[model samples]
Target: MISSIFFYSTAFVLFLIGLFGVLTRKNIIKILVSLSITETAVNLFLVTVGYIKNGKAPILTNTIGSIGMNNLKFVDPLPQALVLTAIVIGLGTTALSLVIAIKLYKNYGTLNITKMGGKR
Candidate 1:
C-alpha cells in the first residue's frame, strides 16, 4: 500500500516538474526535453498502475498444474505493453522535434524561440 502510494506520488511529481519546465522554458531544446520528461513520468505512472503487490509473473509452468480455481496472483501485462508503445512513440516524436529545431536554428541562426520569430 505504502509503496504504491510512493510510486504514484513520485510519478505525479515528475509530471508536474516536466509540465513546469515545458511552460516556463523558452528554448526549443528545453521544451523537447521537458516533453520527454513528461513522457517518462506518464510511462512510469502507467507501469505503477499495472503493478500487483506480491504478484508473480503472468506465466504458467508445467510444474504449476491445477490452474483452475487456484489462488494464483499474476501481475497485469497490459500497462507494460502500453508503456512500451508510448516509449517508442515518444522517441520518434522527440527525434522529429529535434530535427525541426535544428532546421529552425539553421534558418534563423538562433535556437531561442523569441529570436527565431524576429528574422524568420
Candidate 2:
C-alpha cells in the first residue's frame, strides 16, 4: 500500500512548482496557468487530508453487515465533495481569467505583464 506521506509530498511539490511559475513568469497567461496549477495542488492536498489506510468507500453496503462505525474504515467524503466544487469554480475562474488576458493583450498589444505598462 502507498503511504499517505507520498501523496502529501507530491502535492507540496506541485504547489511549490506552481508558486515558482507564478512568481517568475512575466506573461499574463502563464501566470493564470500557474494559478490554475496552484489550485489543483490545493485540491490534491485537500483530498489527501481525508486519506485512510485500507479505507473503503463511504457508501454503506449490506455486504459489510454492519452500520456501526467501529466495524467500518470509511474514507471521509467531505473533502472529496469540497474538491469537486472547487474544481467547478476553478474552471469558471480560469476561463474568466483567460478572457481577461485576451482583453489585456488586445489593449496592450503584448502578453508580457511588464511590457503592458506605458512606454517610458
Q: Please report, in order, the local distance difference test score of every candidate based on alpha carbons.
A: 0.88, 0.91
Q: Candidate 2 residues 1-120, lDDT tens each?
A: 989899899899999999999999998988998999999999999998998999998887887656676878988999999999999999999999999998887788999988877753
Q: Number of the top candidate by lDDT?
A: 2
User: How well is each residue in 4-119 modelled by candidate 1, as lDDT tens digits?
Assistant: 88989989999999999999998999999999999999999998899989877777876455765377777799999999999999999999999999999889987788776655
Q: What is the lDDT of residue 46 in candidate 1?
A: 97
lDDT of 2 at 47: 90
Off by over 4 Å in 2: 66-69
In candidate 2 the C-alpha lDDT for residue 94 amounts to 96
Superpose all Cα atoms of candidate 2 onto the true structure and report the RMSD in Å to 1 decimal: 2.1
The local distance difference test score of model 1 is 0.88
